[model samples]
Target: MPHRPNTPCRHPGCANLVPYGQQYCETHKLLHPEALRSAGSRGYGSRWQRESKAYLRAHPLCAECARQGKYTKATVVDHIKPHRGDPALFWDRANWQPLCKPCHDKKTWNEDKNPVYSY
Candidate 1:
């Protein structure tokens, strides 16, 4: 098979080509680190849990699953974009979507270093 054409990485000053299906090359991704933290960190505190749970309660079906004609029950509320501990993005209702555990895990798999739930 012929090789797929590569695209330039979006990060400034970087000439690396991003692999297919990825936004940034692995090196650039590491350079622009995510604001990751353990569960008990300030950004992942109790208030977030309550708010996320309320979001899920208000929208109790997986958005992705619904697109595929499956009315799966949502167990999690996800950020449409990676918040990376940004309060503005994390709390934005417009950025939130209801997702079943499986859908949530799949959506976040590439964004984060580890899966929220194992398959």
Candidate 2:
């Protein structure tokens, strides 16, 4: 069997190569601590499941889709502002919003790709 080729580290401007299927080289991997945490560790445990489900029940329509004049069913309860492991933000009902999977995915993608730096 042939060995897989190493791939470049995902961190910007990093020249180190890492094993296939690995996202970043050793030096850069530690920079993304969130990637090491499981969904439960990130606060999406049973309690979150229960609360998010109830939130979806109360807000069935996707907020984004509603804005666009569509009636999409919401499958996700997203944080209007990312919780980032902050318990206060995580449990805040006022910061929550209903979003369909597509809208949720798009929003998450954009947020991750272009993070807002708070100085």
Candidate 3:
């Protein structure tokens, strides 16, 4: 049997060669098991992914950045109001807004830490 051509592991700083079909090497994959989870298991499904893509396509700019007069591109579709696991609000288009990853993460972190926090 002949050795297959080696491809670099996708993880940054990793030098390990992975089989063609795999993304991350075994070490990284084991360290980040969530990467192996399905989209639905990660709080998103095909429907949400589709909706998010459409919203981003239409919006293009991050809402928060726009509010500050900056025009950064949005990469996340955020819920204006937390759905709190409610299917109705969770799927509500009116509650959705496109946000850059940084803005979204900061907003989400603040909201998670305090419901009525400011500044």
Candidate 4:
């Protein structure tokens, strides 16, 4: 008769043993599938959205509209280029633009779908 070797769970503070290649214990392994995805991925949800909002508030003036001496209260942050195929651009401040609500929505419809509303 052959015996299988015991493997410890990978979860922090967990002492229970699990099968090889299993990181967490059975109880902890029931994590949501969405939770397994990287935050950098699109449609990963609100965490990334919140971070973008904070960035926008930090720079609450429209960069484009401001350049023309127009003071548009920035309630949204937009990506100059689309972030669909390039998720890395999401956090690039160089690609960010502040715009008022109406202008932001208009740009969102006319431009890329990567505009993150912060209002």
Candidate 5:
């Protein structure tokens, strides 16, 4: 088998090489930190949800819950901090997490007590 040359990332000004057909290098492939805040308002609602579902399906263990050995199926992408007051963090993948239904419900209930809106 012959080795193939890596292609440069397609994202503008990105110098890193990536596999063919990929628009960004590994680091830039995900949404930018600040971009997440307005990503929902920028018309990424259902599309983002689909993406989140796919991500969870591919990695079924809830990031946090799994750390604690909780093996429940992850069904929600939760913001580490409420996106309402900090809209800029909305689209940030680092700010998002895969959570099981029970964990999500608990988080929601906790949020309800604080009452912050992201939408």
Candidate 6:
């Protein structure tokens, strides 16, 4: 079997090369334990894959982009409310919305970094 070429570490400004199938080299990898987690553990197993695909097919346009009058195609099915390991919330289709990659990333960053709580 042919061997795959090593790829650069995904960490920004890091030119270090890592073996194929690995996202970050050893040093940077420690900084992102969440990325190192398995997809199944992150609630992105076969079920989520299937459901998210169907959702994207049904809601092809990004919700955030639509608000801004841009018709971008949604590639991610994001939960409007953070599931936070709650099985019920994770599987709730009503809490889901279609978002493009940029919108999803921005939303995730904001929520993860600066969460708002209703108390």
Q: Best candidate, TM-score-wise?
A: 2
- So what's the TM-score on candidate 5? 0.52
**Per-model TM-score versus the true fold:** 0.62, 0.86, 0.62, 0.50, 0.52, 0.66
lDDT value for model 1: 0.76
Kindly provide the TM-score of model 3 when superposed on the true structure, using C-alpha atoms: 0.62
lDDT of 4 by residue, 6-88 (tens): 78865455699977655667675654232345655554368758866887879888876887899877877777775654657
Please give the lDDT score for candidate 3: 0.82
With a 3 Å backbone cut-off (N, CA, C), the pairs that clash in candidate 2 are: none
Score each candidate by Cα lDDT: 0.76, 0.91, 0.82, 0.67, 0.70, 0.89
Query: Tens digit of lDDT per residue, candidate 6, span 4-114?
Result: 999999776789999999988999776666677887998899999999999999999999999999999999999999876678999989999999999999999987556
What is the clash count of model 6? 0
lDDT of 5 at 75: 80
lDDT of 2 at 33: 66
Model 2 segments beyond 4 Å from truth? 1-5, 12-15, 117-119
Clashes of 4: 0
Clashes of 2: 0
Indicate the TM-score of model 6. Answer: 0.66
Deviation of model 3 at 37, angstroms: 10
Candidate 3, 1-119: lDDT as tens digits: 98677788866678999887676798878654445877587568888888889989999999999999999999999999986556899888899999999999999987754544223
For model 6, name the residue pairs that clash. Answer: none
What candidate 3 gets wrong by more than 4 Å, as runs, is 1-43, 115-119
lDDT of 5 by residue, 1-119 (tens): 87677898755567999776555677865633333346666545897778787777777777768788767778888887766544478667778888887888898778744543233
Put down candidate 1 lDDT per residue, 23-96, tens digits, no spaces.
Answer: 67877676544422356574667988888888888898999999999999999888898776577887788998
